[model samples]
Target: MVPKQTAEIFQILSKGNFISSNGSQARLHDCISHDDNFRILKEYFAHIGYHLESGHNYYYFSQQDETNTNMEKKLEQFAHFIDVMDFFSCLDVKPVTGTRYRVTQIAEECFANERLRQKIFALSRKDKLIDKVIEVAGSLANGGFFEQEDEDTYKVMDAIHYLETIISLITIDDDGEQKNS
Candidate 1:
């Protein structure tokens, strides 16, 4: 019954592996974000040993478990994801969430602007501006922080909740080195 009701929506979300409010795909995007439908679907997903979590206009899963062997590995992945998230968070306009971004566009901007160039330089040892920008953006995309829109275009997506959760964890982390001299 649950699967039937949400067959189309689930097919798209589960396959593309994204149910993005910040996506350019109109039908799938609107289906998940719609209030009444979201409420019903959220309840249905909870029955499958995963709780649905909301983050800034996005949704994701929170597995319910007592003993998971991969917890530490997951934590390490999240740490890396958090660093990548911070990089995106620093961008002005939040990279215009869900919008397509081109490596050349950013590289061109960096070449024309001192601040952007500095930011690119800060990201890598790669001398070429385009390569440096793509390296940073690609890492985030690999981590599910962004989705490839096409051969050269990428779009931020709802799965960014993974990064948001990591950022929240770091925000309250007390295990930092003391700076006192």
Candidate 2:
């Protein structure tokens, strides 16, 4: 494994983001997928207390447990993701991996639908409709789930499957009760 590539992968995963084969960072994804590279990286990252985890065509970091402050931040981020997912779901757009979405298209839908507009406004404090959409997309892009293809276009990366899978594991039971974590 090349030392530079190893360090690059470490920098990305260390941030709690994913390296995905179909993401904007295809070169880095290919680097990590090379022969013995994942193994080498797992051993390397283990020394720093982050377990290297792989999913589909992606890799990310995981810890056995987190500090309370870290846990709080993660929970808060997850809550925001839930709201984002809800907003997309309301558009009848399933949050499927590798899906491409347009900010202008979403904004148009929000303009036509009062409920969607309200949801978007609740998610962001932006005064303009377009700014709200941009803010939401920017958040997902920063998290590595979406990649901005252009100013108004974004493509969902394979890393999004991680978020979808986590959300799917949250089960609701009889009498509309959510399962205890």
Residue-by-residue lDDT tens digits, candidate 2, 2-91:
447777887888897888888767898887778888788888888889888888888899989659998898899899999997888788
TM-score of each: 0.63, 0.89
- TM-score of candidate 1 against the unseen true structure: 0.63
Q: Write the per-residue lDDT of candidate 1 for residues 130-165, one digit (tens) a residue.
A: 778778888777655677777677787767765555
- Model 1, runs deviating above 4 Å: 1-5, 11-16, 66-68, 89-100, 108-132, 158-162, 172-181
Candidate lDDT (C-alpha), each: 0.64, 0.86
Number of backbone-clashing residue pairs for each candidate, in the order shown:
0, 0
Candidate closest to the true structure, highest TM-score: 2
Clashing pairs in 1: none
Residue 127, candidate 1: Cα error in Å is: 9.9
